[model samples]
Target chain A: MALAKRIIPCLDVDQGRVVKGVNFVGIRDAGDPVEIARRYNDAGADEITFLDITASHEQRDTTYRTVEQIASEVFIPLTVGGGVRAVSDIRTLLNAGADKVSINTAAIFNPELVKEAAERFGSQCIVVAMDVKDLGDGSGRYELFTHGGRKETGLEAVAWARKMAEFGAGEILLTSMDRDGTKDGYDLGITRAISDAVDIPVIASGGVGTLDHLVDGFSEGAADAVLAASIFHFGTYTVGEAKDHLARAGIHVRR
Target chain B: MSKTVAVIDYGMGNLHSVESALRKAGADRVVVTDMPDAILSADRVVFPGVGAIRDCISEFKRLGCDETLRAVIEAGTPVLGICVGMQSLMTRSEENGGVACLDWLQGPVTRFPQDHRDTAGAKLKVPHMGWNRVRQISAHPMWNGIDDNAYFYFVHSFFVPADQCDSVVATFEYGLEGASAVAQGNVFATQFHPEKSHDNGVKLLSNFLDWDGSC
Candidate 1:
């Protein structure tokens, strides 16, 4: 049987609470991170990603607790990221029950960290999260962003994705800054590019407003999975509804 | 009394999630322990693992769980191995520069070709993540209530070949046919993570719990 396309609901957590924002700004509290995670788990989400957006060290500890609580309640695979700087950090989250740890800024700072974590924890548990923004200079190329999309790395998105895979990243959480929260759809161009370039699974994140967007993610983008936040968080579409739509569209999804 | 399920912890394995899944699967007393006695004394044992085979073998040996596992298997106690747990059951693995395994199953673990491709000529990813259907090859207790081609979650780069065809109970297509589940006498193992597989996973775990180690 063909492997089913995954539907992942990403929870942007701040201080232990799940939050949502537009264009990575103007954040607003949605609900308790654990509650939302449990809801998604029961609603048939293939997986859940908890992106800890908190900046302070103390609040980061809170994110760890949030991850622990969510992992306890959610049975599906959980991916936690945001401020994952070291192998010890990954170990802490994994010990707390996270199935995979998403590495972003730290991965760029030290690509070896990806290899180290992958070697130590198995590449299956390391997810390299790439935040890509359109160059907008008519180059039609995308560059990587760090610090929650606040800074640009000047590294090409597709190349960086391939590098991460070479460095032993099991999966790539590719997020499009241009399409994030716009609800238009994923940046299919870059998504398909990276998906084609890497031999590891690619999870398309950002800009999923409707079920069709999810279908597009799998079809046009060739993504192995699709991740969204607001659409799932605010009831714009339930996880079951999205899965049903994908199933109807002839995309295999776990029922 | 409900069976006491002991999940072997050699400082590896996703023990927490496995323990939680066992509980959900109706295991009343699930113990995550590295203590060899705790493992041997349990009614059933779950050998779950993740990460590198080099570390897995070292830890398995260092904790002396290797000898304990051998004893449990020799005693015909029902044991379930997941992922690396399943891989380590084989004689050896090409991973970690050719590490030796438990030799419970007469086969070698090999890595999926770096350029592995599906029948459609499409490139397939390694560390085959996500859910895929498992086709049962033979009737076994662990197959109880699970659909013939039910989907289960998987995450691994290397796979154990069904060299000992008699032990293979199920197979899944991922560029090539690899053993998804293997069974022989009182031992059962799966490459997929039943704990992470939701309904199908829970059902499989529950079946393992109810299994009497009889073929």
Candidate 2:
């Protein structure tokens, strides 16, 4: 019996190094991806996700060597995202030994990229991440942002998510544009809405401030996993401490 | 004499961290060697490594450690395997054209496809890496002092598909049922690496050291 909920730490990479920012701005050195990855690996973090925010937009490829470098150093699952536009792109990363590949803007433009990857790699290997922004109206309209949340496309977030799952997306990464760097909390409405709409695993991203946010994403939003930055970077909440709290709250989390 | 835990090293695994970890966890005796009498004499045995299952089995044949391990476990000494070492405990593995395994655990071993929708790995990633939590089940001695749903370090693309539900002490959901940890009497194995999992890892091995197999 596999557990349903998980907590993940996201490391945004640019130019083969780890970097983090608020609202995707003011990128700061988070340290070597390998070094930081080892720290999290030692901390008992459930999973590690590396997003190559600079790869595709800069006409580069996934960090094949770096991915392998990290893989060799740490003994845990590694999920890589960004600039994954084609099947061969996925192949390069996986062959380099990444456990999973995540797609964002590419799936938005080509939809079939998700289906093709899922059909070939199997749905579990395919993750479609949606950087979504709430349009601020009772109309409850949401737009999808791509290219590291730089480009915005006019697609209703929920419906597009359904299409992605239908196309064989094993999991969905839902990040909020409005709350990304605010450290306010997750966009619970957005998280809950999409989670309710899809049967596949949903990982909540953006605006995580404290340990409680991790718990809320799993319980209130019903997200299978939650991702955040400042809280983890600033030494606010450790994964062990977070899991302990989640357990106390009665949410199923790995201690 | 202090209880000894033998981690068989056949030049086929990444056992440095595992040995250091077991040592750090207070296992008074941790030896890495292919000497069968020493392995069989120890109170516990360990198999550790990283590579294709086929290559692992081939190395086992070359060193003849396989026969010694089977004898030791059949003699009822507790034995454990880690990662590729863990996968080698299975009946078969589909890696670099597949290979027969130690048959310690039933069924085939391969990557865990994210969604049940894909199994052959044409789209999903093969080598699943990173930390994922385990959902603990049952009253196996492996659960001694460990809390339920503890996070463990996992780095593999292929996994042992679940068929003998009872053998699985725990499982993980990456998109499907990952036989996260399988224990059958004196033989135990897990997909995650406790050696690399820090304090939690140390605690897990400690539990193994202190296990009485009563509950």
Among all candidates shown, the one with the greatest lDDT: 1
The digit string of per-residue lDDT tens for model 1 on B100-190 reads: 8988888888998987788888778887888888999989989999998888899999997655445789998887888999888899999
DockQ of 2: 0.11
For candidate 1, write residues A107-224 as lDDT tens digits: 9999999999998899999999999999999999899987657899999998899899999999999999888879999999999999999889999988888889999999999999
Interface C-alpha root-mean-square deviation of candidate 1: 1.4
The TM-score of chain B in candidate 2 is 0.90
- Model 2 stretches with alpha carbons more than 4 Å out: A1-4, A21-30, A55-62, A148-150, B1-215
Off by over 4 Å in 1: A21-30, B162-164
Query: In terms of DockQ, which candidate is strongest?
Result: 1
Interface RMSD of each: 1.4, 8.1
Which numbered prediction scores highest in TM-score against the true structure?
Answer: 1
Alpha-carbon RMSD to native, per candidate = 3.1, 8.4
Assess the local accuracy of residue A102 in candidate 2 as a C-alpha lDDT between 0 and 100: 96
TM-score of each: 0.95, 0.62
Where is the poorest 10-residue window by lDDT in model 2 chain A? A21-30
